[model samples]
Target: MEESTNIDQCTMEQKEPRKVTKRKFRYIGDFQVSDLECPKKRRLYWNPTQKFMSSSRRKYVTLKTKIHRLKNRINYLSTLLTELTECDRKFPVPRSIDFNKQFVTVELIQGQFVPDLMNLIIRFADSSK
Candidate 1:
């Protein structure tokens, strides 16, 4: 009975092929697109990384250019401010004026000094006439 039981177990083991579980392989170093052969799979893996790198580089250059332009603008504005300050200091505006005029004729005084209100009244009367 024991011999027959051993024979039965051996036959059963042979009939059921050993269910071998394969361990999925992992990559060690980075593999390039061409290494991954099939075109679609290669594109899926590589394109996004390349695209991101390109866009980021472009953005970096643009930012650098803008910074340079802003620096130049600041320098120009500073120069303009200095010039304006110098002008203000050099020439201040004059506000009030006082004046007197004299005239002489060959035998008499050509003009007379008249009071301010009288001059205005005379001018008004002449205009009304």
Candidate 2:
């Protein structure tokens, strides 16, 4: 009877499922910019990490920086145009003016630099038009 009872207990233990210990894995160290492969996935991960900041915020910051750069470029171009106009008025090339009257008159008013810059501007304007 004791042998039969031991066998029954063994069978019961075998029939029952074993308990599994669950584990959560966490990453350490800084998140690299190269790690973000997918833009859609970037929106999903909500961990408040200093390394991997929110995508929307990063985009906003980048856009602001680009706008600032564009504004600076605009100011630079305006000043450059005004300076060029002054140079053109100071030194007149009557022949070129009559020949290309329709185009914006960029002339060689000073040293080698002015001619090079004027040529590039002329080429760019011609291509754009």
Compose the digit string of candidate 2's lDDT tens values, residues 8-80. 9999989988789743212324334554676643433335353355666898899999999999999998887
Worst 10 residues of 2 by lDDT: 22-31
User: How well does candidate 1 score on lDDT at residue 46?
Assistant: 68
Model 2 misplacement above 4 A = 1-53, 88-129
TM-score per candidate: 0.35, 0.31
For residues 101-120, could you state the per-residue lDDT of candidate 1 as single tens digits?
22323223433434554788
lDDT of 1 at 75: 100
Q: What overall lDDT goes with each candidate model?
A: 0.67, 0.63
Question: Model 1 — which ten-residue stretch has the worst lDDT?
Answer: 99-108
- Cα-lDDT of candidate 1: 0.67
